[model samples]
Target: MRTAYRVETVRAAESALMARLPEGTLMNRAAAGLAAACAELLRPGLGRRTVARVVLLVGGGDNGGDALFAGARLARRGIGVNALLLAPDRAHPAGLAALRAAGGRGLAVADIAPGALTTLLGRASMVVDGITGIGGRGGLRPVAAELAERVTASGAPVIAVDLPSGVDADTGEVRGPVLPATLTVTFGTLKPGLLVDPARQHAGDVRLVDIGLRPLLPVEPDVAALTPAEVAALLPRPTGESDKYRRGVLGVAAGSARYPGAAVLTVGGALRGGVGAVRYAGPAHAAVIARHPETLVSPGTPAEAGRVQAWVAGPGLGDHPEAERVVNEVLAADVPLLLDADALRGLDPARVRARSAPTLLTPHAGEAAALLGVARERVESSRLTSVRELAERFGATVLLKGSTTLVADPAGPVLVNETGTPWLATAGSGDVLSGLAGGLLAAGLAARDAGAVAAHLHGLAGHAAPMPATASGVTDALPTAWQSLTG
Candidate 1:
């Protein structure tokens, strides 16, 4: 699993590590890695020693020190190096001296003319952004912003030190103009901004440099993405001694006469998911039978759907008396339940909170907004915070679906799904996801694991299918996704 920590946590870890190290040990190790990374970005013809010129946007703190020291290393190797200091008065004295001694040119950013800056930036092989450190908040200074604009206009590949300036290291918010790097060389550990969206978009490719601070970091990280091996271990496999009943049964209450295709799609996902049998209870029996002949169809509501290890409710179920009854019956059951789509509308937040059984709420931005009584825009802007709030409020595992699928519970690190393409944003995708996750729940996984694993597999299936894959295609690829984990 890949873990990300907040800015404060990173700072605390850095402080603890620096106390035991020699004065220049950490900075030297960081500079070596940064220089090596920048050199790799310089392609075929532009030789590092003879032709490449790496421009460093030096600021006033540790980030600037990193850039200056890296510039010194490159200068010693005969590469042309120029350090443009945004705050010359406050620049690290030791760093500046080292760069000059190694034949690197140093200049004040304010002193450079537009024509000169543009000309210089245009000829550069690569740009290193060190205008701000993790502790600095908000956007870049005016002079620094202008230099960034010049570099952007130049169309040169940029290597950012630590993180791209102007991004919130803790929240991944980019409110003002900031330099976007083609590659970012971060030190010690990964920051939250490098993983989450908005800021993540600006951080093109990230490479972590070991300043040897891992032992100093806290045991619990803020956010994480599950590894395939971990997911493989979490998944349950049937033994020869296990029967159909032992493998588990998933009960589904979904679809209406208005949208019968939803029931077929939901059942398609459940059948391919790791479950022994699927007991489907809805108004779309004919459609369900036509698609999946093996489904155990119920003549009445889910209340009379017989025994099930877990229940998946909602997805295209229209607002009506019967649909409400199905939702209420499932909620009252002691078995684990997954609520999605139209079921969200029928649920009372108070009742959902009072449920003793494991409940998982899968909602898109709109449904989540309605439940929280906040605007969809607010939820989109702060996805991490919004998911946590939803989980705490409902006292259930909440999966917020988007470009980045996030599953949050009342405790532990929020799991982010780092898979899927924009193509997965199709009709009825959520229905397939709800069924897949529900099946995992029936297979004995907890609410959080079910949601995260379902999302991860759902995304992989989308990619495994042909380009421009539909909801049905994603469902068809479920077996391939599961095999990828097992095999």
Candidate 2:
């Protein structure tokens, strides 16, 4: 798993490490990593090793110090380095001296003629962004923002010295104009901004640079990204002695006459996921059987869907009274539950709190807005806060889906999955996700783990499918996705 911490946590760790080391040691480590990464980018293919041109956008803080020192390293290796100081008067004197000693030239932002900065940026192979870090507020300062805009328009590859400028290190919020980097060489620990969205989107590719502060850090991460191997470890594998009942049964209550396809898609997702047996109950039995001959379709209510280890409800079924009845009945059952789609309608927060079994709620922005009694825009603007609020309010695991899908539990660490392509936004995709999550839950995973693992698998399936998989195509791709994991 790739872990990320809040900026304050990183700062504390950095301070502790700095106290033990000699002066400027941490900065040197950061500079050395940055210079090495830049060198790799410069030497793409064959050719004689000659001087490569690089431009550094220098700011007023230690962030600028990092860039200046890195520029010196590049200069010493036969690379032409130029530092365009945004705050020339407040530039790091020692770092500037080091750059000059290594045959690097410094230019004030004012020294560059009109349009010259863009011209120079266009010719350079890479640009180093050192405009702001954890000390930044709001957005880029006017001069800095303008320079970033010009450089970005130049279409040159950018390597951010630390965290990208104008991005909130703590919240991953981007309030103003920000320069997007092709790669970001972060120092110490990963910042929350590099993992969460808006800012995460701007952070093209993230590379962590250890500055010898690992021992001083806390274990609880602000954010985490799960890899395939880590996800595989969490999955349930059946033993030779395990029977169908021992493996666990997943009860699915979805679909209605109005949207029978929802039921088919949900069951399709569950059957293809790693569940032992799937029992379906609802008005869409015929449709379910038609799409998935393997499904054991029964004419019963959700409560009568036999003994299931877990139950998934609320895809389609509209706002019908019977659908609400099904939701109420399932909540009273002994098994864990995953609620989605129309099942979220008219949901009383108090009722959700009274449930005994672990419950996982999956809601798109609009559905989450209805549950929170807030505007959809509000939920979208602050997804992390919204997901947390939903989890606390409903007393359940909440998975808020979008560009950066967030899964939060009342008592566990929040997880954000950033693996899906935009093509996964097709219709019935969410139903498949709901079923996959329910399958994991039935397989004895915790509600939080079930939601996260299902999301990760769903994304991988979408990526594995033939380019631009339709909703049906995503369902078809689930078997491959599951096999890839089990194998």
Candidate 3:
């Protein structure tokens, strides 16, 4: 799993490591990693060529020191290195001395003219952004922001020291001008900003520089993304004695005459989710069976559908009286339940809290906004806070779907899944996710695991499908996605 901690946690670990080691040991280790990454980007073993130029945007803090020291290392290697000290007098004294001794030329930001800076930037092979570290907040200062913007437009591959400047280290919020990095070389543990969006958009490919701090860091991270290997461990395989019944049965209550395809798509996801049987309870039986003949279509309500290990309610079931009745029946059941789509509408907080069984709620930003009685923009802007509040208030695991799929319960860290493609924004895709999550619940995964795992699998399936894939394509790719993860 790829995990991320807040800035303070990373700082504490660094302090403890620095106290035991030599004064410059940690800094040298960090500088070495930064230089290596920059080297790989600039000169990747070609024919005889002229020396590449590297520009370091040096600031006033340790972040600037890291870049300056790394610049010294590059200068020693016969590369042309120059540093633009943003805070000339305040820049790390030791770092500046190191760079000067190793033959790196630098100019303070105050002394450089706009035309000179632009001309210098246009010829760079790579840019090392040590302008601000994780400790910097809100956005870059005006002068620094303008320089960042210019360099970003220069087309040079920028390697961020820790994270991209101007992004919130704890929450991935980006404001004002920020340099979107081509790569970020982070020290110690990954920061939350490097993983979550809209800052994730700024932080491109990430490479971690382990300064012997992983063991010293906190056990629980604020955010985590499951790796393929970790996800594979969570999947169930059939033993010799396994049967459809033993594998587990999932009940899907979805669709209406007005939107029968929701039922078809929802069951499509469940069938491919490795369930023993999919007992579908909805008015779209004929439409569902046309696509999937194996489904045992119910002739009555969910309670009459008979035995099911867990239940999935609401995809396109509208806000009719019958829909409420179906929702209440499923909500009141002893088995685990996943609520999605229209099921999230007018949900009673008391009914959700009363359920002793595991419950998962999947909502897009708009639905989450409605549930929380807040603006849609509010939920989108602060998804982490919004999702957590929704889970705590409703007393159920909440999965907030967006560019990053996040699963949060009342406790522990939030799981962020980045496996999705832009094509997943199509219609009925969420129905597939809801069904897959429900199927996992039926297969005995907890609410949080089911939701997070389903999201991961669903995104992988979407990515595996053809570009601009339909919901049906995503469903068809499920078995492939499952095998890919398992393998």
Local error of candidate 3 at residue 184 (angstroms): 0.3
Candidate 3 C-alpha lDDT tens digits along 208-310: 9988999898888888988888888887777899999999999999999999999999999988776899999878999998889999997578999989999
lDDT (tens digit, per residue) of candidate 1 on 1-487: 8888998898888888889988989999999999999877765665333478989999999999999999999899888899999999998889899999999999998888878988888878889999998876777778778778888989988899999988888877777788999999999988888877777889999999988988888788888889988888878789998877888899999999999988888888887668899999988988998889999997578889889999998988888779888888899998999999989984687888888889999999899999889999888777788898999988899999986788999999889888767888999888899999999999999999999999999998999977788999999888899899899
Indicate whether candidate 1 or candidate 3 has the larger TM-score.
3
Measured by lDDT, the strongest candidate is 3
In model 3, the runs with Cα more than 4 Å from the true position are 44-50
TM-score for candidate 2: 0.96
Runs in model 2 lying further than 4 Å from the true structure: 44-51
The lowest-lDDT stretch of 10 consecutive residues in candidate 2 is 44-53
Query: Among all windows of ten consecutive residues in candidate 3, which has the lowest summed lDDT?
Result: 42-51
**CA shift at 179, candidate 3, in angstroms?**
0.9
**lDDT, model 3, position 269:** 90
Model 2, 1-487: lDDT tens per residue? 7778876888888888888889999999999999988888889452122447899999989999999999999999888889999989999898999999999988999889967877788777789998887767677878888899898888778898778898888777778888899999998888777877778889899898988877877887877777788788888788999887788899999999999999998988887657799999999999999878888888678877788999999998787778878898888888899999988987888888888899999999999999999999878767777888999999999999987888998865688886777889989999999998999899899999898888888887898888777778888887777778779
Instruction: Give the clash total for candidate 3.
Output: 0
Candidates' RMSD to native: 1.8, 2.0, 1.7
Tell me how candidate 2 scores on lDDT: 0.86
Give the alpha-carbon lDDT of every model. 0.88, 0.86, 0.89
